[model samples]
Target: MSDSSVSLRPGSTIGILGGGQLGRMLALAGAKLGLKSHIYCPDPQSPAFDVTPFKTVAAYDDEAALRKFAAQVDVVTYEFENVPAATAEILSSLKPLRPGANALAISQDRLAEKGFLASKNIPVAPYRAVHLLEDLKAAVAELGLPAVLKTTRLGYDGKGQRVLRQPGDAEAAFAELKPHPLVLEGFVPFEKEISVVVARGVDGSVRAFDPAENVHRHHILFTSTVPADIAPGIAKHAAMLAKVIVVALDYVGVLGVEFFVLGGERPSLVVNEIAPRVHNSGHWTEAVCLTDQFEQHMRAVAGWPLGDPRRYADVVMQNLIGDEVEVVPGGIDGDTQPHLYGKAEARPGRKMGHINRIVRSE
Candidate 1:
């Protein structure tokens, strides 16, 4: 059940379950609101450790650590969707877990997420669950060729996925992603990829940032542009879908809903996935909106009234992946707002930070 009456006054502490860049940003946002953030993660070297004064370097399954961590904070939230179910269960039992365990459980697996969306009357790519190699072959036959096989859990940024363009690719694809439950999805001929980021208050009132049009490189998000080049109604409808999912989950905090915009006389939308927390695609909100996604997330999890989700400027947010973080000095511009994650390594495909460039007023 959702914590409909959750209310955390300023100066209360928020327990964050992951200590990646998202946690770092969330911590920064929390500080601005006079709320403290306590980061709990297995890695002592977690980037969020640098941002928040209170941090717990302990594994998710460490019940004693979790109990102590929960006791110190007024409420808990997570930075990532792959937070272990056991972790969420323990945390929620101890403190108010915004966005709740149900959102985490459903969004953690592709099969469950798709099924939940479809059950809510949202359109999704045709998909089938694949358990064995033979199930993979059979699903490819049913969904037709050019389908994608992806792990049901812990897959992100193009990892844990394989494309099967022909019948022969099934065996190899299954082998590559084997040892984990998988789901096969027929490829949607999408003209553009889009996402909507929204925040739902404890009272169930919701507000959404404008949809962002996205482009990808090597399966990772490369850029997201606000005022997505789509029909107004379509953008409005995309926000509606995000609202529908959040309300259904009785979610608090920011949620991201990704979609594929299929082209025709009138373009249509298909639900791709649900992000239970702040998303990469909504990064533009930091520079362009009166209230950024991170702060909005902090507000929701803290049980405060939501800030404006309205975009004041047309912006493009570009991620500085890997060594791209090294070029920050030369990349600075009058209009570009650069945000660097205090990470030590710049390994390939790693999201180090992002820059937002406001193109015009909205």
Candidate 2:
């Protein structure tokens, strides 16, 4: 179908699953273009509901609720990957689910994600599956120490993952990740982490934003700097890698691909993970790029042609976690774009909001 033909009109409603900050930003972006959002999440105080026009507070498996929700929207998209595979399948049968259910299934499991990358000939760290203690031992022996042991599913922001620096660390690591399928990956001694946020329209055209160098504090992303300090060729390669994956999955909407850049005369970019929706790293685009990732995502899923993913300025985005929000003196300034997710409580390490500062080059 043509891009203009599929573009959602001003009065159309878009359905979103998982009412987190990403969903909130997405709804806001949609509203700017005259579209309305209907948020579907179990949390009564979901942050996205603050911006959306309609909301359905119910479990993913609530068939009656899902049916009613599906009847109200034109298209459906999810904000988080943990939104049960069956949930996507059920909703897809009722309404068009952007990005498709296969994308969620592949990204939900560490093993499945690795396999998909390998299948596409994308470079990833060496990894092995571990279903038992003996399997863990075998994987360690094969992949070696100083690796990471992570659960196969439902892990995020450094949770459900452990780093094993030596042989002695395996037993404790395994014990900690008990009662779950796990995977061991040989750690790559890399110079830095970078991510590419790309989008694919329903027509199969794809576009990618500039890669951003990422810094993690306590395993959670703290800052993202765009126009990543890397060779021009490597930056192009990163965008190519994201495009390859998006086309392979026949994915529609925003997708983020994290990479580890191993420093050398010629840096090697290795895939770290894939996020099926708009990512935190891409938040810099809000102030620096011609098109923000959230807006690009809305356009793609709405079947519009992807916008020019060009960077307009140098930018740095820092996430405000928990108590950090309290320290903002008189709140943020005009130039500093502050986005707060209307969450009721601020607990330690929770992503409360993010601020983007744009720097004009001389």
Clashes of each: 0, 0
Which consecutive 10 residues in model 1 have the weakest lDDT in total?
1-10
What does candidate 1's lDDT look like per residue over 281-359, in tens digits?
Answer: 9989999788999999999988899999887788999999999998688978789999999999999988999999989
TM-score (all chains, Cα) for each model: 0.97, 0.96
Global CA lDDT of candidate 2, please? 0.89
Error of 1 at 191 (Å): 0.4
Candidate 2 residue 110 C-alpha distance from true site, Å:
0.8
The count of backbone overlaps in candidate 2 is: 0
Which lDDT values do the candidates have, in the order given? 0.91, 0.89
Off by over 4 Å in 1: 1-3
User: Could you report the Cα RMSD, in angstroms, for every candidate shown?
Assistant: 1.4, 2.1
